[model samples]
Target: MLENPVLADLATDLPQAVRLQRLAAHLRARFRCGAVALLQLEADHLRPVAVDGLVPEALGRRFAVSQHPRLAAILARGEVTCFHHDSQLPDPYDGLLDTLVGEPLPVHDCMGTRLEVDGKPWGVLTLDALQTGTFGEDARAALAGYRVLAEAAVRISRLEREVQALRTTPPLRAGDDERGAVGGDADQEIVGQSAPLLRLLHELDVVAASDLPVLLLGETGVGKELFARRLHRQSPRRSKPLVHVNCAALPESLAESELFGHVRGAFSGAVTDRPGRFEAADGGTLFLDEVGELPLPVQAKLLRTLQNGEIQRLGADRPRRVHVRVIAATNRNLREQVTAGAFRADLYHRLSVYPVPIPPLRERGNDVLLIAGRFLELNRARLGLRSLRLSSAAQEALRRYAWPGNIRELEHVISRAALKALSRSGVNRADIVTLEPALLDLESNTAVPPAAAGATPARPPAPPPPAGETGTAPGPLRDVVDACQRAHISAALGRCQGNWAQAARMLEVDASNLHKLARRLGLK
Candidate 1:
């Protein structure tokens, strides 16, 4: 009747994101279901704009309609689409329901209804339950009846955005087809809404309007390349090619020729004339990744190109004008490099006109959960598991640990953890898997979230040298040492059930030190 608390918030001036989130939560509560997801159709994919009873990373997922038959069937129908238990179509969220812990159980019921706003197809609202008959005739009628209210909620949220966009940004031209919470390549979207990330996005938006050379400074694996892509896509030259070059990957001998084309026979392998990255990116942007790795000789030429908007091919007679915008990025401290004389001072100054320091994963607060959710989905799909989620303890371990490797490290950790969790015999893809701190295998010490350092589990003392394994008189010293190191690490790993961090503690050494030693002993 639109009088309930669920629909009341639609009239409130809540932020569009908050409003959609609340709508999903209310829908879950109202339906008494396991999870509720509001997916916005972007191109051919269904992106979850808001979700309740889902692991945090679900927001980062983009479900292709072609892959999820249930979603596709729902999208095709104006009426409520119900997939009762035993329906042949696989549920898009097999093991993703937040309620399923330990092992995955088959989801019993799922139903969805299409949402339309302003006479146009909007998206869809889906509800899932772990119990059969949850979406019976009454439930189906209720969903269909509430469909209008759901559509209204979306309509209200959309209008709010349109109004704001009208005030701050230009109107979307006709046929731009820009509607809903979806746009851009789904893979390219940044996931979190943390204050620091929001602030950075705002700053990037401002900088993207100009043609200034931007230097992205951050630790490795912090997604510097992703940020550069976002900047280029946001800029005026979005339609033009955004050429990427890894200065560090370029061979020292070919570095100049790579960045500034080469004439025929410029070098031994240069059989024909070729355009460099800058020329390839003409009328657009050239992304120079690991810019600090550029050799000193190349730095001078790069400085000239940035200043004069011109590049000369190696062995060419003269330089020619080329309109290109430079967006350079590096993990190294350019200022320190300049001070140390490894990088040219003038080039450093020119490139850092607008330096953007990308914050590491640890700084983004609960964003870790959101990002982890994304990874969880990916792992779930990859491992063919019905559901994969982090146990509360595992999530705490993630939050506590310093992400030295940043997002790259996080991706590796999640992927590895999923595999380890699934390594158990008889674990089925239909079974839900919960990742505990043990499975995460994070450095027990480093993975401990900040302020929780004392929470690390203490190891049992070194077991009295294994009841007779005293420093023995073995053969060659190097041979003996290697054999002993390998055996000891192996025994520790076995006792700890293959947890390296746990084994490190049992050995009474730092986890990193243990890793290095293991590698040296061929025990890793």
Candidate 2:
């Protein structure tokens, strides 16, 4: 019976999500349904929290209650609601069955019971069967009984989480002191509690209230756009539009017209008068991503706009006044670009009035696990797994790996590992899938030395030249070392498909340092 097992699960200290997953899996097995899913009630949609025998994408999908009449009907009922095979309402689970192929065939029967905590609907537990009349009166009664236990489990899980949060939360730091004082909309997307991430958040909070031009300097995939949005949300112009323009994506021919609008007859393709991003973002913010990619002529025009708050449209005699707070972001070193005459110095200075550098994932310590947990939950739903977890060795591997792609890379790694583990375990498997270190495939760029973990030995350092060997042209020791370093970096880059970040990680050096070294060696 589910009574004892559910009671035992609640007594243990497993994570709330894990406990819920177990209950859902148990109910699915107990009813012997073709598929079962546990959905959590969000504001206007139902989020699949756990599932079995559903396609991988089922978890990541949200079903609107209004759109899915069957789900709405089930949620409205106090008892289990059964749907016949010939029901006219479309099934949200169509083409979502894991065992199915090609087009989705109609299910013969389906049953659902709403789970409630304290008289409020929490979510719904659903069962589907390919055979007609699979859920008889007895099965329906049993599922309804299980729903009561499921609600209790969810309630206890929530309470336990609250208590745990209360216990683990540390006293507020100096940075946090002003958080409540300067309250605005909170960004739930930026997830992390590490010191570095916290410091970044504090800096973001400070700069978000001002209208100063901000420059977000960071590696690729460090979520610059998300931070830019947060800055816009906290500013005085929160109610106004926040327009984004990918400067690198803009064509040189259309860059001016795209940024500053154009009247008819401005260019060959110009048919009607059109307002550009600057006009669209007037009185608000304009986020220029990869601003370093702007052409020299566009740079000059951009400088004029920044200086006088005016943009002259293409083929127009008059300049239009605009009040836009610019937030520019780039992974490139603008100072280097300025030195190379690739970027204007004056524009660089203007955009960098408030520079915020986001820390990379490798430097964020345990924040990796915190961020991984968020992705893990999403993967669990997307992969239709009851639970996804990293083994102890896998967790250590993740912590020790150099994530060159930052949070974006970490997410892909976890997702790939989860999918790999799922496929290996088979379609009908119903246990918590634990991802081991081997599945992470992080050996190529792991920051932790393999010797420490008794894994494969690292490559030996490059040997010194033979005692009697003479160079073709001898130079200073520093020059010889620089030449050798350049050659080694070049080889590493080639092996890594010309990825500088990966080459840097492989060489046990910072990516910026590698770039500077390459530039000094005249190899850039």
Candidate 3:
């Protein structure tokens, strides 16, 4: 048997979450700490994925790194860092310890270390104690050793799961493969095996079993609706109706009626009684897409429905009870909307009882290629092409280009490029269609630096005035550079359809920096 019980336990074939929880429990027992928790880094927040001694509510709470100095500092470091015994920083685990009853008692000492896997920071492993100096130097050293084992366990578990997925996944028929919908269920299946994607899948699996309101948060085109559908399919209400309501598309005048039904003569167009989406989705799920666009009056009504499971239809005094499990989605930050008096605070909290954030395409690494291949196959089938593939250079370009529009943009890009390639091949009398980098139409400056994938070299800066000849006589070199910058930024903004944030991402600069550059270049 292995000397370390934690490591030995992790080596067993337990589920990933179970193994993680066991690790946390073991660490807590070994160190005699008040609590031990494993938090996963999701975007800008540290979400407790597994906990040993923390209160059950802590598992649902997400702590923003910026708001938590200790977490921010710990994430910044590669090794463990312990807070002072008398540190005054507010604990994220305040009132979250199982031992705590009413109000939060101050924690005496806290230590945290960033959990890294394959050189990437995965998350943080935190240990908190009620007594001072509980986590001494010896304990910190032991924790560091445990961290390595934790990472190994995670990697092993992930690899095993991926292997299992591959083994169990049925092979697609030639026709289905050509259709580009892997598994023959494009609408239902979520592709990619990246760590982030897998984590999301696991979160979905956990939340799917519950009837809690789910709020899907992510940038546009990250497929929040797809996740919502998956959640509904996995839930007990799969057999019931899954009603979709586009809050953004609903007019202010009809918003109330659209959500909560209308009796005859309730409004100018209400010729007959109409059951709203909530009633239509009774005992099932109501997916509210772009929920942030809901007007304040409608929001209040929605909140009432969420709170009391009752909805008063238009021109009706009595309320009808709805057994709908709501799954709301919005690219907009609802918390910010709540602060701005746009979204109701209570409604926001209610909808976000279980928030699931979808990862954007750019952040998903090589999964981009996998998704691109699916799109390529789709385009090939649509165009009736025998073969359509990306050239090595085209593949590099696709990987390098920041997918501002996420998966949706990727599909369009692949489709457009395939069409262009098909046209070119027809003109050239070629049997096979291969898309080149130029066909991708990615902005040169906005694309990732060529050194990234080693497929191309960066173009040397304009040969600099041809020795002494002052090229073009456009004032100084500074002016020429500024002009070039202005043109490049303008082109990027155009490519991103005037989304400044997307433009900034394409240009590989901070959004504020891009704004400053645009202003300085007179291109704002």
Best by lDDT: 1
TM-score of 2: 0.55
lDDT of every predicted structure (CA atoms): 0.76, 0.73, 0.71
Stretches > 4 Å off in candidate 1: 1-8, 100-106, 117-120, 162-183, 444-524
lDDT of 3 by residue, 425-503 (tens): 3443224466778776665324221111111223323423543486443444654565467556555644543345655
Q: In model 1, what is the error at residue 167, expressed in angstroms? A: 5.2
Give the distance in Å from residue 430's predicted Cα in candidate 3 to where it truly belongs.
7.1
Model 2 over residues 69-141: C-alpha lDDT tens digits? 8899999998999998888765667545655443344556899989898889998988988778889999988
Rate residue 221 of model 2 by lDDT. 59
The residue-by-residue lDDT of candidate 1 on 1-524, one tens digit each, is 53387667876889888988988888788889999999998778888989998767678777778767899999999899999998988888776677646344557899999888777778899999999889889889888878888888888888887787555443443444343112376666677878999899878867876899999977666788878887776666766778899775677789899988999988898999998888999988999997876778999999999989889999999997999999999766667557667779999999999999998788998788878877777777777776677777787888887775577667777987799888888887767688889877664223211111112233322322332367643343554445456556655654543345556788899866876675443232
For all predicted structures, in order, the TM-scores are 0.80, 0.55, 0.53
Candidate with maximal TM-score: 1
Residue runs of model 3 more than 4 Å from their true location after superposition: 1-184, 425-430, 444-524
Better lDDT candidate (1, 3): 1
